[model samples]
Target: MRIIGIDPGTGILGFGVIDAKQGGYRLVTAGVIKTPAHTPLDERLAEIFDGLTEIIAETKPEVMSIEKLFFARNVTTAISVAHARGVAMLTGHKAGLVISEYTPLQIKQTLTGYGKADKKQIQEMVRLNLGLSQVPKPDDCADALAAAITHAATTRLGVV
Candidate 1:
C-alpha cells in the first residue's frame, strides 16, 4: 500500500510518501511545502491547497496519514495549523484517498516503540526502518513519515 503522510502548517507543511508491502517499507518521496512569511494568509492557504493537490496527483497514494491537531500553547498558531490541516484533508478526499489521523504519541510509539520517545529516537528508527542513509530533514518531515509508518504498522496488526 502507498501512503502519504502530512504534517500540516501554514508556513511549512511537511509530507512524506512511503510504500508498505510484504512487511517492509519503500520510501517514495519526502519534503515540505513552504509558504513565504510575508504572503497574505489567504494567499498562503491557496498555495497550500495547490501544493497539496499537486502532491496528491503526483503520488496517487492509496491512503493519507495526517497528524491530528492537539491543543497547543499558542492559540493563533494552532488555529492556523488547523486550517491548513482542513485543506489537507479536503485535498486527500478529492484525490480519492482514505485519510487516517494519528496523534503524536501514537506516531512515536509506532516508530520508536515508546510513546515518550524523543524526536531523535523517532527519526533514527524511521531511517533504520526505511533503510535510508539519513533521517529526513526539517523535523516536521520526519514526523510525517512517522505518521505514515504508524498507519502501516496499524494496518499490519489489523488495528485500523
Candidate 2:
C-alpha cells in the first residue's frame, strides 16, 4: 500500500510518501510545501490546496495519514494550520484516497514505543524504520513520515 502522510501548517506543510510492502516500509518521497510568510493567508491556503492536489496526482497514494490538530496556545496559528489541513484532506478526498488522522502522541508512541518521545527520538526511529542513512531534513517532514509509519503499524495491528 502506498500511503502519504501530512503534517499540515500554513507556512510550511510537510508531506511524505511511503510504500508498505511485505510488512516493511519504503520511503518514496518527502518534502515541504512552503509559503512565504508575507503572503496573504487566503493565498497561502490556495497554494497549499494546489500543491497538495499536485502531490496527490504525482504520488498516487492509496491512503493519507495526517496529524490531528492540537494546540494549548496560539489559537491564531492553530486556526491557520487547520485551514491548511482542511485543504490537504480535501485534496486527498478528491483523489479518492482513504484518509486517517493520528495525534502526535499516537505517532510518537507507535514509532518509538513512548508517547512523549522527543523529536530526536522520533526522527531517529523514522530513519531506522525506513532504513534511511539519516533522518529526513526539516523536522516537519520527519513528523509526516512518522504519521505514515504510525498508520501502517496501527492498520497492521487491526487498530484502524
Candidate 3:
C-alpha cells in the first residue's frame, strides 16, 4: 500500500510518502510545505489545503498516517496547528484516502520501542528502517517518515 504521513503545522507541514508492504518499504517522497512566518492564518491554511491536495493527487496514497495533536502550553500555537491539522485531514478525506492518526508517543514507541525516545534516536531508527544512508534532512521531514513507518509497523502487527 502507498501511505502518506503528515506532520501538520501552520508554518511548516511535513509530508512523507512510502510504498509499504508486508516484507519491506521504500520512500516515495519526503518534504515540507512551508508557509511564510508572518502570513495570515487563513492564507496559511489555504496554502496547506492546496499543498496537501496537490500532494495527494500526485502521490496517489491509499492511506494517510497523520500525527495527532498533543496539547501544548502555547495556546495560540496549538490552535493554529489544530486548524492546519483539520485542513490536512479534510484534504485526505476529499481525496478518498483512509486517514489514520497516531499520537507522538505511539509513533515514538513504534519506531524506537520507547515512548520517550529523543528526536535523534527516532531519526536514527527511521534511517535504519528505510535503509537510508543518512537520516532524512530536517527534523520535521524525518518525523513525517516516522509517522509513515509507525503505520507500516502497526499494520504489520495486524493492528489498525
Candidate 4:
C-alpha cells in the first residue's frame, strides 16, 4: 500500500509518501510546500490546494493520513492551520484516496512505542524505521513521515 501523510500549515504544508509491503516500509518522497509569508491568505491556500493536487496526481497514493488539528494558545494560528488541513483533506477526497486522521500522540506512540516521546526521539525512530541516514528536515516534514509510518503500522495491525 502507498500512503501520503500530511502536516498542514499555511506557510509550510509538509508531506511524505511511503510504500508498505512485506512488513517493511519504503520512503517514496518527503518535502514541504512552502508559501511566502508575504503572500495573501487566499493565495497561500490556493497554492496549498494546487500543490497538494499535483502531489496526489504524481504519487497516486492509496491512502492519505493527516495530523488532526489541535488547538494551541493561539486561536488565529489554529484556525489558519485548520483551513489548510481542510484543503488537504479535500484534495485527498477528490483523488479517491482513503483519508485518515491521527493525533500527534498517536503518531509518537505508533512510531516510537511511547506516546510522550519528544520530537527528536520520534524523528530518530522514523529515520531508523526507514533505514535513512538522517532524519528528514524542517521538523514538519519528519512529522509528516511519522504520521505515514504510524498509519502503516496501525493498519498492518488492523487498528485502522
Q: List TM-score per model, in order.
A: 0.97, 0.98, 0.97, 0.97
lDDT of every predicted structure (CA atoms) = 0.92, 0.94, 0.93, 0.93
lDDT of 2 by residue, 1-160 (tens): 9999999999999999999987699999999999999899989989998998898899899999999999999999999999999999998999999999999999988999999999999999999999999999999999999999999999988899
Q: Which pairs of residues collide in model 3? A: none
Off by over 4 Å in 1: none
- The positional error of residue 139 in candidate 1, measured at the CA in angstroms, is 1.1
Summarize candidate 3's per-residue lDDT along 40-154 as a digit string, tens digits: 8999999999999999999999999999999868888889899999999999999999999999999999998899999999999989988899999888899999999999999
How well does candidate 3 score on lDDT at residue 118?
A: 98
**Candidate No. with top TM-score:** 2
lDDT of 1 by residue, 1-160 (tens): 9999999899999999999998699899999999999899889999989998998899889999999988758999999999999999998998999999999888888887788999999999989989999999999899888889999999999999
- Stretches of candidate 3 off by over 4 Å are none
Evaluate residue 41 in candidate 3 and report its C-alpha lDDT on the 0 to 100 scale. Answer: 91
Compared with the true structure, model 4 gives a TM-score of 0.97
Candidate 3 — number of clashing residue pairs? 0
**Alpha-carbon deviation at 109 in model 1, angstroms:** 1.0
lDDT by residue (61-91, candidate 4, tens digit) is 9999999987869999999899899999999
